[model samples]
Target: MSSLSMASRNLRRRKARTILTVSGIVVGVALIMVLLALTEGTATQTNGLIREILPAQVTIVNATTPTGSGAGIRALFSSGYNLNQSTVAEIAGLGGVYAATGQLSSTAYLNGQTVLLAGIDPSSYPLATNGLSIQSGTSLSTAPSDQVVISDTLAGQLSISVGSRVTLGPNSTGGAPYTVVGTFSSSTTFLDRSVYIPLSNAQGIAGEQGKVSEVYVKVVPQENASTVAAEIQDKVAGVRVVTSTNIATAVSSLTGTLTTVFAVIGFVALLAGGFGVANTMIMSVAERTREIGTLKAIGARSSQVLKIFIGEAFLIGVVGGAAGVAIGAATSLLLSSLGGGAGAGGLGRGARLFSGVLAPAITPELVLLSLALGIGVGVVAGIYPAWRASRMDPAEALRHV
Candidate 1:
């Protein structure tokens, strides 16, 4: 019989032991697959959200000297820079500029719950390009005074609908009452938790009349975004100009780190599983000592003996990896489905984290990598045992009890 067939027959003869070895591999491979699926899903969702929110646009924020070394620290404490209507006008007038608008933001209590309040010039807002779709009622127009547009998620949280009046600010006492004129839908998690009002109203409420927190600029088609960004930086001094590519890169870096952390965890599990396989193979070599000696005496070369053992290990890896993939995929899907509704209670930070991982994305690379990992573990685990079987002294092994 062929080496592969012989290896198959040997494993069949010890079905219980073989199954146990395969089970260990299955568990490890399954864990790896699950972790990879979640990591990939999270990265994909985050990148997509970033692109949806900041596509083809440049964001300008107040520039500040870094008080600390890290970007995070600088972002957290940056102050003293503001964008006014004149800056917005100048950016709009720049060559290759499609649209420019300024936004004012603040934290306010809405219907007894704190929510992100964003003020934008309705006439200049890039609604369509920014992926904000009005799901119900009329959008804020130039006539906006007390009219507001809220996200579907915010609507659910506050139990308010279009035409529903809601109180804003601290205990609903800080700003004039506003009427909900529209509800918008956005795929982004953060944006979905925000309420939008006319820039004039927002400025009035925040006591920052004639000032905006940031400016968003959209470049005309067929123009280089980087070039425009540099120009904007030169023209608009005392502000930070961030292009869409910069935002995407930052998002990608964050997700890449998260993926690496989970990958390390999965690798550790797989390493443990490799040890289990090695132990099982070593025991198998001991049990088959006599058989190996007889085969060598009967014309089986050392190479053939090694192939037999490696083939057996490889078969185990194949079976275990396939089974693990199926189980892992099912488990991930189930968990994602359950986690998708976690934001129903509120749009708090915890809810956003959970809601972001709404589904596990299974990619071809993930499947192939999982299969390769399992087989690689099996092959590495079998090496010493296979070598031991191949070097067995025929005369001595034949006398093994």
Candidate 2:
């Protein structure tokens, strides 16, 4: 019989133990696959959202905060100091500037739940943001009316619709009621959580009258966005300007940290599986000492004996890796399905936002990588045990029996 055939027969002799060892490897590989899938999904979605949401060429904020540190609207408004509304006109008048708009942002309470609020000028907001996509009812009219537009995501969360009367303020008390004029869809959970009202009302609510939280600027088609952003930074001494590149880098930094952390955890689990494989191989070699001596006495070379043990380890790795991939893929699909139900009631706002956007991506490269890991671990773990079995003296091994 060939060395591989002998190895296969030997493994079948202890089927239960071989299965237990393979199961350890499967657990580790599956865990790594799941982590990679989640990170890949998040990175893909975030890149697409960055392009869709921040179409403006340049965004201006107070210089006190770091550039690109607050790429999201909520972070930008909450951290930066206010700039006077006149700054909008100054930026608009600059060379290569097509238009500019000021926005006021603040936190408001709605039925005891914290809500993000933004005040925008209907005419100018359209010029800067290209206007909100209204799913139902009409967007805010040009006049500063006491009407509010909500994000469809928030509307679903609050269980309110257009023409629904709701009250919002800095606190739970003494707030005026406004009618929901429309619901808009921004296609991202981050921006979709905000409630929009006239800029005048937002300014009044935020208590920063005559000042705006951030400025969005549209550059002329013929001009370079980088050049315009640089000019704005040089001329406007108290403002920080950020372009698309800066925002993308900032967002990547946040997700990159999470990816690194998860990768480390997965690797550690794989190492533990390796140790289990090594232990199992050692015990198998010890139990088979007499059989190995008989093979050597019957004219089998040491090299052949070594191949028999290593082949067994190779088989275990193949089976474990294949099983791990299937289990990991199935688990990722389950998570994606659960995540899709984010709009359902009973979840907290933070949980809803994360689940709403989370999608686990299982790519072919990820599956191959996970398989390679399992095989590599098994081979490395078996080396010592296989070597000890090969170098054994026939006389000593026969005595051991």
Candidate 3:
């Protein structure tokens, strides 16, 4: 029989101990797989969302101001920054710019529940020209001043439909009542929970007439976005210009940090699994001393003995790693599904944060890397025991009890 076959038989001789050791490796590998899936999945989802929402667009925010003498103590608050209709007109007139729109945003209460409110010039907004479509009722262009459009998700939450009058702001006494002229659907999550009204109406309600929180610019198709962004920055004072790519990069960096933190935790579990493997191998060596002596006497070299032990460890790793991958992938899918359901139902803020857009994604690279790590752990853990077995004096091993 071959050394590897012999090793396999020996492992089968102690089924319970072998199972316990393999379980340790399985747990370690599963932890690593889950961590990688969550981090990578979140990054991919965030980037996709950024592309969908901000594609070929430049977002301009209020610029930062120095707050202290220290290098990193500058205050980047845009609390007082406000854009007006003239600014949007100026952006539209700039070279390489196709269109511009102003947005006014604030928080307001609807039927005792807080909701996001956004004011936009529907004609100039990119969503109006893109994938946004009214599912019921008419567009903002024909809607009256007291009428507003809302997302289907938000409408469901409030149990209100088209032609329904919803009170906005504090309450009936302090809030302004508006008719739901339309319900719209889009590919973005944020938009799905938002209420859209005419720019003038939002400004009047927020008591910030003629003022806007931000401006969205769509550059000409043939122009480089970065070049247009730079030109906008040069032309517009006290505003920060950022491209869609920058948003994606920022999100990726955040996810990368989270991945690193979780990976360290997974590493700790793997170390524990490695120790379990080493302990099992050491015990196996002790139990098989007499067998080693017989093999040596029958012409098995020191290298051959070493290979037998290492091969046994490698087999355990292969089995354990495969099982772990299956379990981890299933767990990730279950968690993501649950989270997505909760978010779609408008359960809570935390639940919505991890809903459909942040589901775990299992990639082939993660599986291969995790499997290799498991095998590597087993090989490293087996080294000392294999070395001890190979170094035993044949006569002494033969005399072992």
Candidate 4:
């Protein structure tokens, strides 16, 4: 019989042992796959959230004060520093600039509850955010003054809706009453807790009429963002500039570190599986000592004997890897489904914060990589056992039986 045929027959004779050995590999590979999927999903979701909420490619803020690294999204409610409103027109007139708008962020109270308030220009602000996407009633353009658009999460919290009259001002007890002309929904907490009003109204309310918290600028199509950001920093005095590339690089650095940590964990689990495979192969060699002697006496070369045992290990790797891929993919999808479902159908701001569910991304590369790792572990584990079986003397192996 050929070496492959002999390998197949030997494995079939020890079905229980073969199955147990493969199971170890399957578990290890599956764990690695799931970890990779989760990390990939999180990175993708975070980047998408950044783009959706802050669509502008370049952001300008006051250099005198510290702000969120990119566009001050995390500093959404802070009013510590301000930039001149005329800076918007100056940046807009610059070369390679497509659009520019200014915004003022501050705190407002709604019936004793603190909320984030944003003042945006009705015309130019929509260009930066791709429109606030009002879910009900009219936008700020329709009722520019004394009208506000509230997020669905905020709307649900205070039991307010479109056309409902609400009071918002510096304090809870004393404030100006404004009609809620529109309502909007956002999957991210950054936008969910916010209430949007006209730039003029926000300035009046915050007592910073000629100042804006930050400026959002869109680069002209086919223009380089880094170049524009550099120009903005140079031309605009006392202002800090952030570009989309900077944000992406910062995000990548964080995710790369996270991926490395997960990879080490997965590799450790897979290493344990390799040890199990080695032990199984060693035991098999011990049990088949006499059979191997018989084969050697029948003119089978040591090299041929080695090939047969290695072939069996290869088969085990292939089967285990395939099975592991299926299990891992299914488990990832199940967890994603459960996580996504849990965040829905709940009321209030906390629920809304958890509503942005990121599903696991299972790419073809991940599957192939996992399968390759399993196979490699199996082959490496079998090396010593295969070598020992090949180098054994016929008389020495046969005398034991």
Candidate 5:
């Protein structure tokens, strides 16, 4: 029989031992694969999603200090600081602004239901939120319908739809009603659970006549977005400036920490798997001493014997590595599902819960890492076994079996 075929037969002779060993190695490799994949994917997506939502020219808010500069430290403690209307107007009037929309935000609730309400100028809406889409029914116009746009998830949550009249509550007066004129399906968390109405409507309902909370300024040329933003930060008051890149950087730091912890854990598992492989190979050598002696007696070279043992170890490793990768992915997927399937359901927004970020995903990088790790473990496991096999003496080994 060929060397490979003979080796296969020999391994089959101890099926239970081989299986147990492979299982141990597989579990270890799988954990490593899943961890690495998740880290890499998170870093990549965080940067991308941040850019999409907060483009270069965009500005964001955070709590600030009395000195004017971003409360770089204060932001960590609290948020919900308001951006001024006059400052927004000035920025909009800046030489290169294509459009500027004011954001009036508040933690709004319907009796027992707590939700978020985002106020934007209907006339300048497209400049701020990308665009308001009407998934069903008609688009809401600024006019004076007290009409509001709702998201699909929100619609489902409130059991209200087009033409449904919902009480928006006291226009700082005690009670007022804003009609739900349209329903939209923008996957964003703000929109999903949002009650979007004209900045005028929100102002009137909240008992405030002409005040704004946040400002979204789009550059006239789009290319001068960054330059315009710097001008705003230098001149605007009561506003902490942020862009999509800033959000990406902040979130990436958090995810990076988690990724590092998981990688270290995966390394430990791989180390343990390596030890298991070594023990199994060593045991196989001791058990098959007599067989090895017979082969030597029949003129098999020491190098050949070493090759055979090492070959068996490599096969085990390949199998284990593949299995480990599969397992790691499964674990990640399970965790993701439990955490709400990457949904926009967190409460980090300025008085609003924008589900802008989701959990990390499994990817090809994870699979490759697992396989490479498995191979490394297999080689280590076979070293001693191969050495003993190569050093065997036919005369002495004949008595071993």
Candidate 6:
């Protein structure tokens, strides 16, 4: 028989044991594939969404503080920076400022639960609708009335839908009724829990006329957005200027901390799979020691012996990786299918949902990573066994039972 046929026959000698060993390698490879796919997909969508909204502009905002009040003001008073109407007007009139607009936001309790109510300028909104993530309903298009947009989370919390009326208590100007004209949410933290309203309407609720939360400015054809930001900082008082990039960076940094923790936890599962492969391979090596010696006695080189063993492990990894990828993909799809594709209740991470299915993106990089990790595990696990086999004396091997 040819060397290849003999090796194949020998591999099948103990089918059960071989299958078990291969199964371990497969699970390890699969774990790596799933993690890589998920991380790559999430990072791509989130970072891309940030870019779409921010888009090289600068924002002037009032820094917040805690309001200290005793007895009569029993409720918590959050100190907020309100963008002065005059400051915004001045910024809009500046030479280099391409576009300037104002916005406001406050925390309010609806049915004893906290929800964010944000006020945006509807007329100037098209100037920078990039910031609002419209998951469902229509964008804030109608003239400023008592219409408000809410996030999917808030929608779910309130169990309300578009065109429905709900009471808004931005400071309890009688918790006046507002129609839910639109709904929005970002998969990220920002939009997922917000309520949007026209600036004029919001003003009526807060009872604070001519005051705003921030003024966003887009610079014209200049890489030095910061230069204009500096100019705004100099001209404007009681307010701070921040670039869209700056806000993205700050939010990204905070989210990154959580991602890092999850990444470590995800990687630990990979390590556990690796250990399983190593343990299984080691045990297989011990059981097949005499057979390895027999192969070596017949002039099979050390490298060939290593290749056969590693190849076996690799085959197992391929099987497991394939299964794992399918499972992970199904999970992403499932999330999208459950009304997560569109509307406020959908997945906020900009995942493309089709036919009510959130598809987990399978990319080339993930495939490559899975294969590479499999080979790495196989080579690592084969080392000790290959060494032991290489060191066996041919004469002594032939004498064994």
Which number leads on lDDT?
A: 2
User: Total clashes, candidate 3?
Assistant: 0
Give the per-residue lDDT digits (tens) of candidate 5, residues 1-401: 56666666767888998888888778778767666766666666566555434423576463352322223312322224555566667777778878877766664654335556767777776765566567888666867567777777878877988888776653333355667878877554434566777777677655555666667777767777677777777776656676655555666665667677777877787777778878988888888899899999999999889888888888788878888877877877765555453444333332221113334466666577678789779878888888888898889999884
Candidates arranged by TM-score, highest first: 5, 1, 3, 4, 2, 6
Pairs of residues at least 3 apart in sequence or in different chains that clash in candidate 5: 30-324, 60-242, 98-220, 170-174, 170-175, 344-355
lDDT by residue (tens digit), candidate 1, 203-315: 77677789887777877663666888889999877877876667556655655665677678767877877887899889999998999999999989999999999988888
Over the stretch 265-292, how does candidate 6's per-residue lDDT look in tens digits? 5556556655665676666666677777
For model 5, the stretches where C-alpha displacement exceeds 4 angstroms are: 2-20, 47-57, 62-80, 110-112, 170-174, 188-190, 207-209, 220-224, 341-358, 399-401
> Local distance difference test, per candidate?
0.74, 0.79, 0.74, 0.78, 0.68, 0.60
Per residue, candidate 3 scores C-alpha lDDT tens digits across 321-374 of 887788778887987877655543234533454354556899999899889888
TM-score of each predicted structure versus truth: 0.81, 0.77, 0.80, 0.79, 0.83, 0.68
> Top model by TM-score, which number?
5
Q: For candidate 1, give the lDDT.
A: 0.74
3 versus 5: better TM-score goes to: 5
Number of colliding residue pairs in each model: 0, 0, 0, 0, 6, 5
In candidate 2, how many Å is residue 329 off? 5.3
Q: Which sections of candidate 1 miss by over 4 Å?
A: 1-28, 52-56, 65-81, 127-131, 173-175, 268-272, 295-307, 323-347, 350-360, 387-393
For model 3, name the residue pairs that clash: none
User: For candidate 4, lDDT tens digit of each residue in 2-107?
Assistant: 7778877878888998888898889888888877786767667767766755557788888866644332444433587889999999999999888899999887
Clashes of 4: 0
